[model samples]
Target: MLNVRLSIGISKILLSAYCVLGAAYTYAQSQRVVVTGFTGTSSRVPQEVDAAGSEPVNALPSWEAKAWKGETIHNQVLLQGGTQQQQVSVTAGDLADGKGNRIPQQDLSIGWVKYVWTDEFRDGCGYRKSVDFDSSLVADRIQTGTNTMLIAAGKAQPVWVSVRVNANAVPGDYTGSIIVDNGKKITLPVKVTVLDRVLPPPSQWHYALDLWQHPAAIARVHQLPVWSEAHYKVMRPYYEMLARAGQKTITASITDEPWGHQTYDNYPSLIKWTKKKNGKWSFDYSLFDKYIAFVMDCGINQRINCYSMVPWKIAFRYHDEKLQRDTVFTGAIGTPAYNEFWSVMLRDFTRHLKKKNWFDRTAIAMDERPMEAMQSVIALLKTIDPAWKISLAGAWHPQIEKDITDYCIASEARFPDSVLIRRKAEGKNSTWYTCCSEKFPNGFTFSPPDEHVWMGWYTAATGMDGYLRWAFNSWTARPDEDSRFVTWPAGDTYQVYPGPNTSIRFEKMIEGIQDYEKIETLRKTYKATGDQVALNKLEAALNNIRISNFNQQSATEQLAPYRSLLND
Candidate 1:
């Protein structure tokens, strides 16, 4: 959250963010449109539109009105660490002056000011997506993307307003305004009264959702080569979104092709391996550097998971420059020559990461290798760098738990309660992952958003520190229209679309993470004050939650009633 506003050229970033919305369309040639904001639910806009359209409508939604009078709307909010949002429906009508004179064919500029402290106007306001959730909290959340859009003369669109108060924001009343230019001026007031409390930074967050990213998918979506700047630009938003969701590790590919079906096909290698004239092995790591830097720049700086040390099947080719031919290298785990090659490669890679000051946070990742193969791979890796962190995404290998830095076990592994509890107590960073096997609580579009939100709560309930899903943006071939691939459910291939715009499932998952944080925060706060009664109440709130019950209420709705406990 703290790293979000590091300006990489605000205008350039805005252009990139608004690329989907084409250049500003001319509004002068169209009939002037009236815009008004009103309280609304997903089902209906609460107020009737003014047909007379004589008065300029409020451009900003009210943050303090007691009731909606159709002409003005007001709602108040309490500051929280996570993001909080409210939507106001904006309707447009034929423009007219208060004197009932119709004004037509004019262009208007649109803009909004950072919510100032009305009292201390210099203090800026940021936006948040969840209530007191560390991950989505932003120090500067009030800025809108592509500030201008043309409103047709008799149409309506919803202007979603969101606010976030950072963990350390000073307590006071803050005010801001959203201005809609229609040749005539209309301003809507926004107000916030920050309470005297601070949220812990993300380092204290307990829920970890490992959203694995597919850079190749990004390249395909943008029609660019892997590691190209164009690819990085399109991929930045996705990684940043994950970072905002409290993702702790960055997933990277060294050379293994993505979705290779356990064999090489359309997937291209990022690591280039070459066979020298003297029969020596050489690798080019230019691609890895570009990708790692790209992800780090987007705020995924804590850990790097370079997947994978052991690929599904070890088969790679090296080109012979002198002979002008390619030689495919193939071997099973523990083949003397293959082991030697990987030992050298990993040694070089470890040295590279150390040079970049990334060795400590780096892990050599593997996916679903057999226990025997995993042991062999670990042995080979340790020969190169004894301190190298080994990460595996598969069933738990009890014998190798001590060797693993992060073990993402599948749900079907059915790890016993004792083992799970022991792992947590031992300070081992482990988690659970779901793929084709997970059904009820999943990220599919058909599934309720609550399931996504339930993930964080479930993880906490089960004594796990995080959750993991294989595909971040592993889009289907027809990603725009469908999310399903041949091997998995329709939405299983990806939880988000190409724009890096989120899906309902993703939104709900965030809600769950926020809820998890709130529960943990409440427990910590009560414990610190030695209030056993309040602590028991907080525990009851968590104990009462169930994955099956999530569908009954949206996460926000269910969590709202506990605000008194949280506020106190």
Candidate 2:
């Protein structure tokens, strides 16, 4: 009996030792590096290892995305020209082995996602608490130039991978892998299934994207003098980026501080106005010509939207050659002074634009002005040159609807079917714009990333020509660092960053625009083939996409079915 008892005790001790060894082995394995993939439309905020709870390994699942040829798709990975984006999250455990030896950081193929201070405006719009509210650092800009990232122990890092499927890529399943080298190779597999249909390139797409540009913002952010050679050199990549997204309008301010200094960087006039000593007005088109030519060279040659015959403050500035100083003309719309002020400049400007062959493409643009004021401006523009094209981003007024060539109404308003049809027939463009006034489906930093892409689909469903946004790069003081503003919600001022870096919001918006192009292409092909069945089905899917549905469903959820149908 004593021998049997001693044997039982030895067996129990051995069993307990084995269990302890097994747990240690398992924990050591878990302590190693981990990589997971997520969709580009979804943004993953980095969480501290401690705050991520006891299990951070299972935070996300694998990544997969579908796209059409020539479509730009966003995941953590991106594909353009048949592009898709895929985002990969890398989490490090203790960064040491069970033996306590340190492990090397990984090499990311694309770049790391940078965190920027962002405020959660939730569903509110226009002027809210900037502090003492729900605010945190959100991962946004993808560090384009860097190819490696160092993740601290117990923290995670996100990497953005963009893959461009050639425009002529065959329709089939394609597989690729993102390799993370951390001494030992960690492979993250990427799978993409390209649909049979083709999406036209941005230049050919019918969707007219008009994201207003603020060149001064770019100059300020880069610490370069406005319009300097260095400024132009730096501005090239930025404009080229805009061109890639199918931007249709060139935003030019004819008057100083066009919008009453609403942006962080005041918009200096592109065209210099000079009043001569002999009481005659002369215009200098040197800067205007150079900027417009530069933008056209960058591939955004569609339309030039010159800001305001009526500026927000009803004030105009000119170089008084007589006084050898700058002068401001404060004249209300339709007044004698206002009429005289614009008439001389318009006549000379018209002649100069005609000389450059830019008159036909140029529009005297206005934003959110009253109907009465717009009518007065339109009348004045016609008086200067009946052939003048006009553009307005404001409430739709039927009284002056026929006069504006590029009419972008507020998202809250819609153009009547008859009016839209007439404008389409007249070769005029009608679109919609969203700003701080809107809460849901905006490009605010706190807003869901999917909303940016949703705007493209909404434009397609509503039968609008395209979409317009006020500020493409109206960047705040430190846009790359923080996205908050005193006047509006976070990210309201800009979309892209200083490194000329692209944001998840911006990339996802491009994805949505590509979707829009795909929809348009499919519609045209089906109609030409007399495929009424396909047309009806497509229309049905689009009809279900309503702004009202935003609350009940996510943009991804709404897009999934239509994407599946397209893939089929």
TM accuracy, model 1: 0.67
Candidate 2 lDDT, 1-568, residue by residue in tens:
9999999999999999999999977765455455554545455454442363533323334446676767655445221110112232333221222343322233113656777888865555555666755777777887776554555555556667665554665666665556655434565665667667777777777889999999998889889999999999999999999999989889998989989998888899998888899998888889999999999999899899998776779788898988999989987888988888888888988999999999999999999988888888889888988999999999878899999999999888888888888889999999999888787778887777878778888888888999888999998888888898877878888888987998888888887788787778778889999999999999999998877887798777777778665655
Please, what are the lDDT tens digits per residue for candidate 1 over residues 259-354? 354211144665777768886767787877777787888877777887665777566655777687976566777889779767767877877789
**Candidate 2: which stretches are off by over 4 Å?**
1-31, 46-63, 77-109, 122-129
Model 2 gets an lDDT of: 0.77
**TM-score of every model?**
0.67, 0.87
- Tell me the deviation in Å of residue 56 in model 2: 9.5
Question: For candidate 1, what is the total of clashing residue pairs?
Answer: 14
Range of the 10 consecutive residues with the lowest summed lDDT in candidate 1: 115-124
